[model samples]
Target: MKTNYLALLSLISILPLYAQQVKFEDFFTDQTMRIDYHHIGDAKSELVTIDQIYGYGIWAGSLLHLIDNFNNGAYYYKIYDEATGALIFSKGFDSYFKEYQTSDAAINGIKKAYHESAIIPYPKNKIRFALEKRGKQNELNEIFNVLIDPADLYIIKEEAKDKDVTVIKALYNGDPHTKLDVVILGDGYTSSEKAKFEKDLKRFTDLFVSSEPYKSNKNDINIYGVFKPSEESGTDEPGAGIYKNTVLNTTFYSLGSERYLLTEDNKTMRNLAAFVPYDAIYIMVNSPRYGGGGIYNFYCTFVSDNQFSDYIFLHEFGHSFAGLADEYYTSDVAYNEFYPAGLEPVEPNITRLLDKNNLKWKNLIAPGIEIPTQWEKKDYDANDYIWLKERTAMNKNIANLKRNKAPKEQIDAAQIEYNNKDKAHSDAVDKYLKSSKYWDMVGAFEGAGYSAEGLYRPMLDCLMFSKGTKPLCKVCADHAAKIIKHYTE
Candidate 1:
């Protein structure tokens, strides 16, 4: 009886090891399968429908890590072997449709549609694909599922688009399968601006590799740039009544936020990106506007010429790559209840602090420090409130001036005045925050994720929380390092 019991325990220990030993060639091919679909719905209801499937470039994702263990993103997808019904692959990603659902238009029962694509390793046989979304209580519920056959006649297998597009190998470490691959695309650069695009790509790549956790793991990354010129020189500024014939159709004023820049042309972007192997996408606009946007595992965008361009690049990538939540609650955003009350956010940087003993980043908390570590919130908020109001009024005034076709000198002077004041305020705030007793500590700092209360950040100041060249907080850095390992190791 003792021998039998010991054997049963031994069997249990080996089960998980066997499950983790899923081979890549067992159920997948060497190519890529992209499932395109239309995500339709409003705030109350959502639906997804198949559009077209494409067979494209060689698979670039990690062959070892087929399953995503990170519980991130608003939506999740799973691929299963049809014959055995065993889960083979899965990933979590945020989509533009998910963000749009939180917009006022969706809240008012206005339905919209967004084209999205799911890229996976080509299957060796028939497979079942399923997509799940997070409910109000943070549980994933399956919303869409379909059976896909590898040999389907309707699958589009064609030549790669934009063969003539310039490809710049900004940084190459090794095989893409063994490294985290990042593809950078340019928009709104005219054909004559090819040199400028290359220069901009090099600058961004250097900055990316110089920043820590990426800086520490630079050898595990590969960066590529896909440059396709547009007929115009800059992206659209709808609030200022300016439009351009850009390649990606990127624009500012996304979801009514003046500085939020994003592109809805997912298909075109994907087509261009097919030229290379990538795990993440970044769009670099040719404009000088102070605008950019990022969605977890979806994409990130930033303008090329701006005083805060470097900060935006690093900050937005934190969201797109590491799933870090915004740590600032003072700024206005189009999202309504982005992080719902009474629930913990999936982002690693911010939490609801429901369980003090089991904090998301409990291991990193400072020794003997309080869980809800208090900071100079009242003093900061008082100044932030005044700055926020001034910023809104300044943006409105500039937009109106542009609409009225004000002289270039007049517009430039107004912008200069505002920029000067903005710099002063930012400098003062940074100095004040650095003087805090908890500035160098790792503890739950209140006021994060668009909530002035409840949601707590991992630090007092980080790239996610402010407009500076600050490194990611310790919690965010650890999460990012894990993601890097997921791709490379």
Candidate 2:
């Protein structure tokens, strides 16, 4: 075969720093190689060991844009064309393993291992796969690197498991390779609840597509429902004294945070997801409780029947899909200062404002807008603290009641009071913030990335900032649009 290194180099010369420099066909096959591994760590250390490598259906990601230039994850993995020393494919991602290290257990010196996986377009020849993680300074540091040979006899060639899996196309507009492929899996729905799962999938997808970037990019997206019915009908709620034999092993009270729902069974989740082509995973648990979680490029989980399912589904997807950081800081979270002080965050929405000389999104900043813009932060923070404090106490009481086997009436009453208090405080802030003067201003607003004092967001009220009645801020929309294009463009 002939080569065109000069032309290819010239083609990518004007491209972004992380853009793929090699032809997709020159190095990759149509299939995907899923590298499953165990990521083990404590507060101060981490390690990853290969579990198995399997052929996961077709490659659903962009064939034209093989390299990821987005750079929006706590951890990143890149595949190199060893013969030519050129980058072929890469992706930025966050994992439950990394998030787990921030928990009280790990911080207190408890060690644990998490099951995880990363998939890439299958390569034709030997290639080098390097896994890199961000440090406290938020710099990309290579932690693990290995050479993968396609002809190795040890490479597993198993078919997609769960052949009985019933998949329905929820949103199909284009080819998998040319469009964003999203797979929605049901965690605790049983055979009897398959219809409900389908219905919820439609509802979830409808709301998701109605959002900013997704609303405009509907034609370039494909959504599917992969139903692996559980024996029971709801996820395990450890704090609520309820447990179920769910298919994906999802549970609430992750890291002692009541609402941080997650699943530790990555192997099973990936196996179920293997039933279809997927660029991202959205696991909807069959429950009415208010809880969910998202890990970048890994998966996002939401409780399907909750009152706030729609909002949470989209919010968590922002984290898992586009790597949007949480702009709200009042609520309790597992991590301590997840965003570092000096370095810039990889997410598009939040900024540390350390480099006033070079704003990350200075081009989008409207003229005359202050860099560290002002808002009703004192008022916003005041109401937010009241709401969060009450909510925390409410959750704590409910958990205790459940543990004591208190009457169902008592539990319902506690939730009702909390809900009423939540509604009143939310209404007060929303009314004040929604006033014409403060809305839609795109600048650096103090209080974001889990810190009310240090971090600055691009807008006053955003999907990341608060659950207010506003679409994504302009900054968020731009970042999300780029992510959508990364898959479909």
Candidate 3:
């Protein structure tokens, strides 16, 4: 009798707390489709660049929102699935203008633009988003209601700041509750362009939300954009000249080149981390320039631009966001011998094949498919191959004949042709590796596995790092899907 009485009391005491949990359906009505952009300068008019249409357009139909904020930013809370504990949604908004001027300036500009027609002076300063989670815990419950199976619940308060940048809190409610969020910032633009940028993002998110993986748990995701205006519109490197590629004409300040290169600037990385507690943070470089990078357990991202921007965006996202290893290895890179032969690589595509009897995907290989020696000298003719001959001879320290060493009279002819053709091969590799839809994993491609010396990939044309129908090998797909399952509710 005493035990029953205690159990009843426990139930009574927990009822209030349980009632406070936030549910996913509650915030649907509260979402506001707002316009966002930055004022770079008056030197350029409010014009839409072609790069924007192509690059950002690729993700045209996607959904994004803050997973943890509600009720005009009164409180904040993040949601995670009970089964996996991966964070699927979040919004951590809890800052006032006094904490930083970013949200304040952005709010002012937005308000001004909403009311006036005149062009406003571009804010020279850059605004970063930050979250305040230390105080004001009471109001959180009213705005957000935490829900597990829509039965248990809690509430929380959050605040959204309008300054030089519109900053909001975010959270993860996926299976793992793995703290992850992305801040998609745009380049500098005029007031009109800023408005357009916001519209474009809204459209993109709408499409994203309708997609397969995201549509499954649309309510649990939080996505927001911070309008940090650069000095000019389009692709550009800070304090550098504009670069024109096949798809975009913009300043390419990062490494001062249109092609992909790492930058010395760590500000974007540091500031992004400060905004939210993220297990993985991503930077969506707003340019039509095709490039991206992924720092494991840190961050991953791609730039915005045309000229194969859609393909490159997904490709880079696979690398930066999913840790997918490069599958193509024939193109020129500055590094050498990245992967040792003995150590087993974590990436699914490349393998030591050390123990073919116990190989990773041995079952998938066709019965009697020739293992090792499949790509012996007989596969490729040794002589009369100018490109292969040069690379092989160089690696072997073999000197070329007289005519090969002479400087060519055509300045841009040979090098340009080489770059263009080489890029085509790389594009082909990227396409195959990212498709993630087909292929059996038995061996390596001729030029993959980070072997600067060899150009082999696991499959004849798998997406380890190539283009077209040779979908991402099976192992790579499983690896990427594992992460998706981890973070989805």
Best by lDDT: 1
Q: Model 1 over residues 54-166: C-alpha lDDT tens digits?
A: 99888989999988879899998878676766677889999999999999999999999999989999999998788989988888887988989999999998757665599
lDDT of 3 by residue, 1-489 (tens): 435533543463445443345343432222211112221211111211111000000111112332322222211334333332323344332211111112333334422111101001111121111122222322323221222222112211122333555543332344223223444444434445666667645644554445434445466565555564444555544322233221112233222222443322333333323333233344555654345544333344455544444445445545644556676554444232445456554445566666667665565565666554254323223321344445444322211221244344342354444446545645643444445332343554344654534434456554446443234555565555545544442
Ranking by lDDT: 1, 2, 3
For candidate 2, write residues 276-322 as lDDT tens digits.
88999999999877889988889999998765677788888888888
Off by over 4 Å in 1: 1-19
Q: Which candidate achieves the best TM-score against the true structure?
A: 1
Compute the lDDT of residue 381 as modeled in candidate 2. 77
Clashes of each: 0, 0, 122
What's the C-alpha lDDT at position 422 in model 3?
Answer: 44
Q: Order candidates by TM-score, high to low.
A: 1, 2, 3
**Candidate 3: misplaced stretches above 4 Å?**
1-162, 167-182, 187-192, 199-222, 235-258, 261-263, 272-279, 362-368, 373-442, 452-458, 462-464, 467-471
lDDT of each: 0.90, 0.83, 0.38
Candidate 2 ranges beyond 4 A from true positions: 1-19, 161-163
